[model samples]
Target: MLKEKGLFGNIGVQVVIAMCVGTLVGAMMGQSASMFAPLGSIFIHLIKMLVIPLVAVAIISGAAGLGSSQSAGKVGLSTLGFFGLTSAVAVALALFMGVVFQPGVGVDMTGVEGMFSNVYADKGEMPTFWATVLGMIPTNVFQSLNEANILQILVFCLFFGIAVSKLEKERRDPLINGVNAIVDAMVWMINVVMKVAPLGVFGLMADAVGTFGFSALMVVFKLFVVYVVAILIYGFIFYPAMIKAFSKTSPLKFLSAMKKPQAVALSTASSMATLPVTMEVCEEELGVKNSTASFVLPLGATINMSGNAIYYGLVAIFFAQMFNVELGMGAYIAIIVTSTLGAVGQAGVPGPSFLVVAVLLAAGIPIEGLPLLFALDRIFDMIRTALNITGDAACAVIVDNMINDGPQETPEPESSHHA
Candidate 1:
């Protein structure tokens, strides 16, 4: 018989209750609830502290385990291809939804003028494509880590990991073991920090709702609806279809196994934090091989951001529509490409909403609209993080099927011995 889960045992239940209570408190107390903002801020900071090391070590360890450069290259290419394809499709779907729904219509923009002006005043020039690519190559690795530039850190880890894998066993074994130890340590830290997730989420929700109240929510309610609809379609429809089409896996079975990891993702709102759970579910529940799960899931955590792609596309178009900026064919295409690429480069950390800045700048949408979106970001972050992990697990199944020729078959039960 399965053991019953206690109140504290289910983090999802705790977080949901916290969100509801926080919203109620915020609605009741208004600005006074803003006092709780620091609680959430501290939680976010704790999560961010792990991002750089966790990403670097995860990637390094995963790459080092690929056994050969050729195998690494093949898996790397296939993994990136899957991420890129799914992200592009997600962005396209979001764009289609944005155009069909037109979520920004009939919206009030009265108090937002000050925010727009402030952000506009501080807006820097958008970087060129080549310059942006060049920026990924870090001049100083330490500086990149200090600044938490994920793309730069990713580039460094890729090179460092590949180089390490080339070393003879004598030299490589120690480095590999050391990196694995660090990855394990970081995961342990994640578990410890996640213990306070309920309180953290409570503070975040309270502050968000308290400060903005219902007005902000009403203004963007349509956009929120559109975003939720898109997420549902992608998570329920797109992912399952892909899994079945590629691997003949039962969609119901896959989603059933994903429950725990999805819960963790929804509460933490950070893919990096949810990585360990995702890996566990993929291997133990879904029966994905460890070698494939280890390599694909970590890389997917870094790059496979289907949910972010959708959000970026939707937000860029929403802002464009709100600003009455007419987008040409080229502009729409740019939105698709830029949003997909932006999601690719986005760090798997909390507060990924900031990465939408690049999407807006690329599409010539005003940066001032970001503050408006920021108000609703936390709720969306939960949804998107869940989708991100789902996509990761699904990709693992597909890749495993391709590389390993589906799951290994279990031997028939041995005849009972009748001594």
Candidate 2:
């Protein structure tokens, strides 16, 4: 294992500096800043190349370790329950903020109107319950791997991991060791890939700022401000409070340790790409067990999207207010349910989200102004992603506390080594 020894060597510091520098360059260069896209692209590609394999092996090792424990069933159920509870709470918070702030009230859409169309009216209708369930079932797992279908891969890995846990001790030990060895290899690969993370962050920020421009912010700046407020509430205050109340973890300590992974999430704007960094930090700094962190973190990245839930809830309010559509009791319920479901349905990848469209339709809001938001989606996505990974880590810490018997996070003061 290798560690960044000092402040300048610290990846987090380097990335933060790169982000600031990139933003200035992008603002100056405008769209021409896109030349930096390749630096970001290669960085993202390196991270993505490891995601599928890392996820599969991590889940296998994690689930297998848990399956050997008596609390396996409890941990799984508790994890799901925690995610659902937090997501519902996130939507409620967003709705409250949207109403109080009134960000979309009396906004002019003079020029952006032409950008809207019913073309996307047929937009991605979320899958049916059975469809989503069946989709998780990989008919051909190898094909799923080739296609990089994360949900399907997760399902197969959990099942295979459990089965491995049932194996005779001699046989199981070697397989688990092999799977864990693969995870270590991934850590090494991530360490190597992260050498360029500062450059990647710079390129990504420059390209996004240059291409999207900040002009769009004027129209939705209110919504954007409210959005950030809601995200910070969830990410910083709510998550840390959860850790303090439910686990032995010090809120301040956990928050401080999480900076590196959150930085990665902010820059990449994709939880999947940030998964490796999140896992390392959880295991190394947060003291979450490999067994617990591996299973919970990967699963959290895949399905627990409290951050996206906030985005959906707020977006619904933005449109409903701008169009003067009054939301009824049922409409509020629909927003809450639809937003939570839609958020979970989404893969933890980066792009302009269409899930908000479904949320709007569910609450009978206008969809015309969606494209306007799309222009600034990357900025919104980056902030929310940082929040999303925080929730994932929070869940891992709390759930690990609930079922594990004793302290798992031994303080390691002598070693500055990292994953």
Candidate 3:
């Protein structure tokens, strides 16, 4: 008999089954499925509750930690450069695929008209470049957090972290420890929240499938296919090639060892949750030194989001097509820039489906379309989280190579050393 993977061991399988069952019930029950919407809402609210504290603490701690070390500056610069380059590539690739596939070309918007009417009613024109730039700097940090203005929070945190990093060790240690404590608490809260994810996902899927039926999914089916294809290319082709080029480690072996963490990321749909496993795989299985893996992987989990960049680009273009919004070259350029920035700024924020609002605002796309995207966000989240962790591991390998002059030899087994 095949061994059962148990509840947590088979979470990905459970979620997939939940999605299918939700779709079936929704399709049969029609409008009645809307009742389950509250379950999803509560889940989203729980996620949102953790977002501000978690993001602020993670970013602040990560930035301050980097500033504390000497050679870390070099590592930080290298990591950022790698992240920027990879994110740019991911977004550009997404845009290319979106244009080629034209997934939103024939989507029927009649069903969602009522849902978005209020949003479109108050839709203002896109802000100018300078205005957008000025807006990122918060006039009142408290007000920014209250309003959940992520860009402003990001800006404030960057400066605050730098200031903290410059403080004397005696002063800095207390603050760092305090922030670390807060992060730990927030993560614990997230774990508590995630126990309800299957129910939440079921409700979300039920409502979406009931309201629009399979027809809505059909409209965006091409977009989904294109995204999956793009991610697979990144995961299987791009990552392996990058690893081979930068390090002497066998890409196949690296991927084999990464299976556990990747599974965790896929199931949990949270990079922060998968960080410990990623660190273990990088150090023990992939032969990276503790110093390099420790610094690079955690930072990558927070800011290096190749997957979100791609999703943002594709979603921006998809919505632009859906709404028949004509985007100029300037608008497309803005999409690339803002999407990249938003991915970094919005890291660790739950319910990222809505975080695309920042990109839409920048690209002049209607925020009204967000509700439509939110319906299918859970499905996309699983795939992107997997890609995100894959990118993190690839980065650790590359950074290790740069710092240590190619892959270090795997350490001798403990038992053999003792013998």
Candidate 4:
């Protein structure tokens, strides 16, 4: 199901080609390549169009069905706790590596001085972590839908789905069937939109490269290299180890099964845009039950950001090293806490990350040189989104495996997927 027949039909190959060509074109044309940004925007918008509805439908269907599980509450809590734990681990790793490697030491600040700004400082004070958690509840669900507040949508759908589950069997079955049919419809729409992924990826790469260029990277090439290594360590090492330790699934098999969704994540750079594909691969390819895939994947796509956690931790260390500021024990704790929670608070949408600002301030690091990283965030976003989806899949696989071992009245959470 993940494969395409001919060479040209392979969307993954096509996306890679587009990414390369777009980077080349951007380098050649410079800021003029900004014209292609609309192409990327259109694709993202198309994907966004389906995300809210797909999430709602899938969660409703999954939760309603999972309502039958004796340990359903345990399943949901475990998934949340797993993400938070992994993110915390990842940030701790990043901080350790940053301190050991010191990629930010002896940096030139000549050109970096001009790009620094305080405008983004206000972004840090927007919402405390508790406030963001509280805000997940929808005051008006219709308003939540209109605003596309995913967390609120998730909460509302769970309440609605559980209420439906409590209804008479005759009533519940019909509504579940209806919601699932809509799930299939949304999946089809995502498929249609994905055909143009190459065009959209090209635009995104061009705009990001054209505007940012590689000049800014020269000063921080060492940091970029270290950043990539940290990402690879988490993506390949930590995640695979988790799969090996916790699930019957092979690490190689789980990684190979992840290719299609990872490609989409790379091209689109939005975990929300890639959710449908993630759900599909999780259920069909990895043998994750439909219910586990639905609930865990959607929640993971929204909040699980181990990669971002790594980035935040490293960046905080990067700045501290660059300034020769000694980070005390308290600073390290602050970095870990802030980065882990900040990454968790991140929305799945692909955009320049402002959460890094909050991490820096919380740890008392200066935020002066952040614009350089902001320019490079698109590339970073692509990489991290892949990690996010991988985490989503890992959680689903492990959680599904755990549920299978538990006491259950109904073994199957739903009918066969893609039926």
Candidate 5:
């Protein structure tokens, strides 16, 4: 009976109800609700535990499966290009928000220790750009895997897959085929993990509701509205204009097709978990080729972070504002640059990224301001996850267009979305 309603139907329903109930009960009791908080934290950890392996194998396997390593570079570059474009826009929007809203005025909060306490600027004897590039070459594959350094793994897979694809049919085919088989197995394991995502999400929701209740909800509501407005305007209007200029597909049609996956992304609040559905929507619904979808979607899911980028900037500015931290022009630039880079560097889980953000705050910045938002992170996470998926879809369309000779004939007219 429960299965018939769907995993989303059951788990999503439970989570919302849990949040509402927890919030109501906590409010009545005149205390922060602790019940269900542990469950939620555990669920978040479980989802996080799956992220490292899932990201590494998914990228490697996705890259190698693209037929030749040469094409893999093409896909990787396209993916990076998409990420670069969206991230830049995100930072710009954040800066604009900071300036227009003047979030950094007359705020005060006490800084915390043992957390992110410094800016990501002027590290002593920093490596050169070329050196940083070279450093991506993993010395030990297993070491990279253990550390879950996605960029390094992606680098290895692109070149290695290209080499395998360039070999004689007998040798290359067997090797490439073997890697695909392994990737498939890993994907299956990821699916098994996702089966419990609702439980995780539910626990996360319950804890957040119990702890923060009404006041946190109000803050989250404000943040959500602001961020969603930014993402929607940029994703739907600005991005579509860019797409129309560069690609043949209608942007509205493109976005309409992605709605189902986006909905799932919003509900789950995990880009990686929503990937399988997003990939399907791109291929079956939007007519993106399998190679394009596989190559673009996984990479996007891992690194392409429009929502995270914007959140970093806005949150940083917001925190600085709350703490009455005066960020001069140089400091503002540093915030934008560091936040953008950190989005790439701290690419695994939401929690770890905060640690990176904490570093930004520790540098005589506004670390104390961050805790003000912690109570509302989960709510913002849902919207950000949706925006992340939207960026993925947009990239898929752009890259698919770039690779194909031109546009294919349009598909039959029908309602574009599917659940």
Candidate 6:
């Protein structure tokens, strides 16, 4: 019977059926359905465990490869330029979406202030953006590997790769080749692990549905609308226009190629896990150099979180309003700057955003309002991850174009025979 239906096809069919069954069971039994909840929670935890390592290894390896390429300088400049341009566009689209959709316009969050009391607080010691930059250099880079100090790891890898690039050809090629093989192996392992994704999704959904009950969907709806609008604006209007304005490639064509990776990102709700696919799409379909695309997209996964930044801005505003904490012009400016900088250093974990939100709340607003955000986080995360991957691809394409268009020095031919 299993062989009669294709494995993936059967799994997909099962998920649809399970969702329908879960919906019916939920509507009938309400929160009394306890069986699937624990199983689902475990599944979510397992997936979350993979995120930090996946990001650290992928970025370190990708950066090392990028640094080795002949066009390293051109690639680096283009990547930075692309990140700057796309990030600016993302912020603009987020602001526009907030105004146009007004997601928080009607939600009565009078009780939300009380919720913030349960949120975590930093004891007068949160690092400044510059301090955080310096902290990336771990006291012991190897010991801190699991903790995922990505910036430090990246810094170390960059210098190491550059040094390798300058080595004698015989020595350098073997080392680079070995590392490349390891990266390829890791990527292959991740793809294998992803085969169990439907089970994970089912587990997570079952748990959320069982515990939260149907009424929690109202919060989900609000976040869903905001997230969908934000993603559409960022992926469609913002990135496409930039591609057309900056690159030789057609924006529509580029977007079409990105669809598979975007879908994977949304499903996995992780930018890091989706990095390999993002790199592949950019290099193959978007015409980004493999070395450049590999490096920039991985780093972008770690640092260029435009979606999370938008979420930071919106959530800070939302919770403040919910708590009836009036912030003047000065406070809003502080939120924007701190949130944007903080997001770059954010870890790719399920609830990492909450920590940032908690910091903002601790600054003066109410942290208790975070429970409301938590209730809607999964829905929002799906969209946020998708938006993040889109920015990664856009950065790669623009960077590729810039490098190709830059000045070129023709190389002289070698003589057929030595004198």
Q: Which of the numbered candidates is closest to the native, going by highest TM-score? A: 4
Candidate 1 residue-wise lDDT, 294-406, digit = tens = 67887788788999999999998888889888888888888888888878877677773666877777777777777777777877888998999999999989877776663
Which runs of model 6 end up more than 4 angstroms from their true locations?
Answer: 1-61, 69-71, 92-102, 109-116, 123-126, 409-419
Quote each prediction's TM-score: 0.88, 0.94, 0.71, 0.96, 0.78, 0.83
Candidate 2 accuracy as lDDT: 0.86
Candidate whose lDDT is highest: 4
Candidate 5 global lDDT: 0.63
| Predicted candidate 3 versus true structure: per-residue lDDT over 1-419, tens digit per residue | 11137864454455566767777889998889989888867766776676666666766765665556554566768888998889888989888988898877887776666546335324333455678689889999999889877667766876787688789878887887777677666656765676676687678778767876765566578888988998998888988999999888898998887777776565456676666567667877888755566457656776778888889999989889988999898988988887777666555434545447767777888777666666666667867888888888898888777867634434321111000
Ranked candidates, highest TM-score first: 4, 2, 1, 6, 5, 3
lDDT of 5 by residue, 139-172 (tens): 9988987886767776776566555556776666
Model 4: worst 10 consecutive residues (lDDT sum): 410-419
lDDT of 2 at 79: 94
Displacement of the residue 267 alpha carbon in candidate 2, Å: 0.9
Higher-scoring candidate on lDDT, 2 or 3 = 2
Clash count per candidate: 0, 0, 0, 0, 11, 5
Would you give me the overall lDDT of model 3? 0.72
Model 4 segments more than 4 A misplaced: 1-3
Error of 6 at 382 (Å): 1.2
Per-model CA lDDT versus the true structure: 0.80, 0.86, 0.72, 0.86, 0.63, 0.63
TM-score of 5: 0.78
Estimate the overall C-alpha local distance difference test score of candidate 1: 0.80
